[model samples]
Target: MTGNRFVTQALGEYTLAGLANCSAEIVKTARPVNLNLFSIKWPVTALVSIAHRISGVLLFLAMPLLLYLFELSLSSEAGFRRAGAMLASPMPRLVGWLLAVALLYHLIAGCRHLLMDMGFGETWRGGKAGARTVIAISVLGAILAGILLW
Candidate 1:
């Protein structure tokens, strides 16, 4: 076996030495590292992209709670009433509205991404416009969801 070579019984063969060398070389390169996120002025398109990811994560995290409430609502008549009452409270209503807004934003951003995949909004100008449009539509959807929920 060579100094840079390693063998794994399950994986057959692998080499970490090359990866280590490559990372070391990368570290030696002079690159500007901005650790302060707040100091950077992010573009609208970048902000929208970040928000899209955040909304997706929020939706994923809320899924279990949503499914539990749904199951409770469908379990029995009393369970249905209890679930309704629980959702009727201020905090639950606020959470539900927030989830609704996140869902709406995610859906809108997803549509924008699909459009981009289809060759639309590939340019800088187009991407910025699409991001603005997504924000506008999401805001409108949030207002509508709030009205319906409240």
Candidate 2:
């Protein structure tokens, strides 16, 4: 029966008994959330979340280009050579590196999310640490991809 204290207060002319449980119900006024894109500094966890979403979208949009390249490389010998030559150029190489980096980041972030969903790294400190680890690994993988691309 241990619970909140009942504080009786006056409302009008009638004297009420101790019936109001003010301590039981704590209400906080909600503040208006400002979502100005450039006004707020995001934390590491938020940055990782945003990058995860962006990387996923980038991979989805690059699917058509990847499919086209696959089809071109398999169509004919000349087409295969053309595809190879196209990939050899600087612009295409850069784009390929970017796609590779995005894919790596998305994959790592997805694994982190899965682990969190499975009850791992569920605490606030653990979540932030996991996010930092994901970012560090993704950056290292991206650097290796860039080195390979060049």
Candidate 3:
């Protein structure tokens, strides 16, 4: 009674003090850490994956801005010219180039999704082939964009 002043319910594993000690041990032994690439150079497939995610994020975030510009353009003629002048700027042109690339990536990835939906790229080999296709298409789109923009 002198040492054990408190007890949990009848079916319990630990008192509050016991739980605190257990948690401290767990924290010391099981601290979370990031999976840093210690010695490996980045792989092409990983780059492609990161690019895909970036393109997706860019498209999602740009959608709102693009929609707002559209709304502003429709509000009045001055609004239309303002939006037009913004697009005509060097910075906006660069952003447009980025958006175009993202759109191309999204389109190619969406086509891959459609193919998978249709049961085309199901197996590991098929998935690899589809990834190859994405790489090819993404490169092709870049070439096309370069030609168009230049």
Candidate 4:
């Protein structure tokens, strides 16, 4: 028999009412939509971890601005003064502080990853402890820098 005619005959037999959807065991599926409810507990450690990654990305994107500043400082003593003076502006100072913190976090995280690669933090507990150490170091460095800056 022709393929078209066979398909038509098959459809005529198992169709539900007028339409052709009579296959057994229809499956249902869904993706979890996270609605921020008050009942949900936000993890501080997770947030800090995400912020570390975001800061890394911010640092990467700010490379051009940083390079410009660096070049300006190295160009001449007058250029150094001008670049230094730019940091005196509140916005630039704030950005500089953020960049410093990002640098600290990146450095600490890199060390942690390096240790992990050396088979130090291979287990679950080891990883968590390493993360905590990174946080502590980053926080202490940031606090020290902040105190000095402010």
TM-score of each: 0.76, 0.73, 0.61, 0.69
lDDT by residue for model 2 over 1-150, one digit each (tens)? Answer: 000011111111122222143233331222223334344445577788889999999999999999999999999999899988887889998999899999999999999989988988867677789989999999899999988777
Q: Which portions of model 3 miss their true places by more than 4 Å?
A: 1-47
TM-score of model number 2 = 0.73
Clash number for model 1?
0
Model 1, position 113, has a per-residue lDDT of 89
Would you list the rank order by TM-score, best first? 1, 2, 4, 3
* Candidate 3 global lDDT: 0.68
Whole-model lDDT, model 4: 0.70
Ranking by lDDT: 1, 2, 4, 3
Candidate 3 clashes: the total is 0
Task: State the TM-score for model 4.
Answer: 0.69
Off by over 4 Å in 1: 1-28, 33-35
For model 1 the TM-score comes to 0.76
Error of 3 at 130 (Å): 1.6
Residue-level lDDT of model 4, residues 33-138, one tens digit each, is 3333243333333444566689899899999999999999999999999999997888888889999999889888877767777889656566667778888888
Residue 116, candidate 4: Cα error in Å is 0.3
